[model samples]
Target chain A: MIFPPDSLEAIIFNALSETVESMVFEEVVINQFVANKWPQVENSAWWACIELFPPPISGEVIIVVPDALMNRFTEATLGMGDEPPLAEENADALGELLNTLCGRLLAMRVGPTHTFRMGLPKIGRGDTMTQEGNNHKLVDCLVEDDHIYLVVPNQFWDFNAD
Target chain B: MLKILIADDSKTARMIIQRCLEMVGVANCEYVHASDGIEALTIMRAGGVDLLITDLNMPNLDGKGLLLAVKSSPKLTNTPVIVISSLVNQALEIELNSLGVNSIINKPVSPVKLLECMESIMEKGFIS
Candidate 1:
């Protein structure tokens, strides 16, 4: 990883903040009270993941959002009035959000000149758990009162690891 | 009225892009949607599309492939393309420009940005 742990964390936070604010017109703040590790599986309703490939670095970015927050995101993205968005609609919204967030995070970390490729976002509902290891990093955030988690696992920083 | 074709895998993204295009004062236009580049190409082949807006990453053919297909074809070569994506950098921008992309708009797109890009393309006579 080109950035130190703290720097990477800050980058993740900034990317998440900008993505959410721009896409959904909502504010995201770091949830200091929550631990950086993955939260309880039941609390999360949607999990979206995208793989990043940029030369010597590679990893997957996962975004976890609870049911209420997902509803808010879907409604905002689709501009729904009364009827709830379909399951596929929610999945698409989450995937697009993850795609944008991962792209922004990579651009910020890798600079403007370096090119990077990202896989299409894959989204799923129900319980999902993060891989267990010190090789990964997690950032907990809040959109209003709901919690969201951003996880980068495996080779997220393998190049600089001691 | 101009006919615009939007190609993106996500329905949500297509809706948002259409909303932004409307907000950017592209009101008197007919909109067509495609789930990927191949579909967009099919629609273009049918004729009468004034512009093409596409997302970079998609299944069964991407924006780059779509751009190449359109620019290479004699019938579709004149149609303008605008790429909206999150995976943009200087290198990619140069590549897209070389491939005849009229404009590139970053994701989390807004009406102001869309309008600015459209105005620039309009000045170039890509759109009237």
Candidate 2:
């Protein structure tokens, strides 16, 4: 594995924290309550997915966020005060966030010299999607009162057997 | 007034980069936006673009193709290019440097980092 399970968890947390804080000036903390299942939210959620291409180690990173939190993020990102952001604006914000997050995660996992490519982020609205695999990793996070999730297949780190 | 062109498929990214540039004290600049590398190249070829700040991953031509077009043109070769991308690594950095990229900034860019990179470019007289 590229990193031990604990180390992988830490990397995910750090990457998410850095990306959210810098992009939207918001802090994120790991959600300790929901261990396996996706968080139950009253509002509909939006998700953004991006594919990572590192040759033999390929995987997808998905970020899920509720509508309200996403709206807040969109407003903060566009510097919109009071005025509501357009639908396309929200999608763009989520796409950019996922793009940045995926890149940061891959860089942390593979280090400096290794080269990687990522497909454009795909954003959509849907019920919570679940990954049914033994090699899936989830990092549930709380941005203020909202629950956000970062999901990826564990095989992405199978390159390093050490 | 400086005429700066920003090329990125995401509007949010372009806005953020523009905000970062403004935050770094780059005032009195006229900004042009393009959604893809082909559009950016066309805009650059039209003239009056003082600087080009682009994202590496984009539809149509992409940043590498845009950079190649810019550097190969005798008219646009002197115009400095700064790449802001999430997919930055040692190999990509080396390749971008070889292609005459003035600066490379990672995603979720802060004003301080943008300022530092701009300052370095300013020192080299690439951008005034």
Candidate 3:
């Protein structure tokens, strides 16, 4: 996966734009992102990631963002009111938002000639860890200041406790 | 024959873009697909991609990184890119355009409007 980065950014940025329109309507920016993860790496609190798979046989696109940003995202996504259910409600909304983003990405990529099904959304705890594998490409991005991490792989890896 | 590559994580988006480009009457045109920014780059690297359309937020490389990477490449020097999105940041948009994006298509896109956009940039041979 050592291709130029623009095309990949277009995929994520375009998907992020479309996903928000169909789902929540929160216009966002595709902020700059990097690959390494700390020490000799570059992971941060805003990191988010996802994996894509079969029929499509691709991988997922994972994304991460700060908690405060996630909170705002939940409010924007659910369109909740004064009675919004607090942190619990935000969690549910976050999962749904990511799910919608993934589903939209696959359908767009495969075109009318193919269809891909997405599994239920799993929200990673800020500290989730990822393993390396082939047939997979990782995408990291930011939306309106929220850090987003993603992956498109042929199979599902072990789920961390996030 | 102008070659166009559309990279997005959304299926609906791809359709909308395809329909829009058709409406613009871009004849003898080619449309390529990439699920994420990373794949988009891969497709472009293979050649014949004259215009690159992408979103800002995506898995793997995301939009900004993608834009930077593409512009940074010597091979893609002549290729033009269009940034279309709904991400809630204006500064990012300004930055992208300033960095040399040919145009910016704000979100909530439709077949009709997209077509109109294409028409704005239509050249002589795109239509019969």
Top candidate by lDDT: 2
Off by over 4 Å in 2: A1-6, A32-43, A128-135
Stretches > 4 Å off in candidate 3: A1-162, B119-128
What's the CA error at residue A54 for candidate 3, in Å? 33
Candidate 2 residue lDDT tens string, A82-160: 8888878999999999999888887777777777888898887775454554555666778988878877766655667
Ranking by lDDT: 2, 1, 3
lDDT comparing candidate 3 with the true structure: 0.59
Q: How far out, in Å, is residue A25 in model 1?
A: 1.3
lDDT of 1: 0.83
Q: Model 1: runs farther than 4 Å from truth?
A: A1-6, A32-36, A54-56, A128-134, A154-162
lDDT of 3 at A120: 41
Model 2 pairs in collision: none
Q: What does candidate 1's lDDT look like per residue over A5-102, in tens digits?
A: 56656777778888998888898987652233655555348888887875736877888888778988999888899988888889999999998888
How do the residues B1-128 of candidate 2 rate in per-residue lDDT, one tens digit apiece? 99999999999999999998898789789999999999999999999999899999898888999999999999999998899999898778999999999999989788898888888888999878
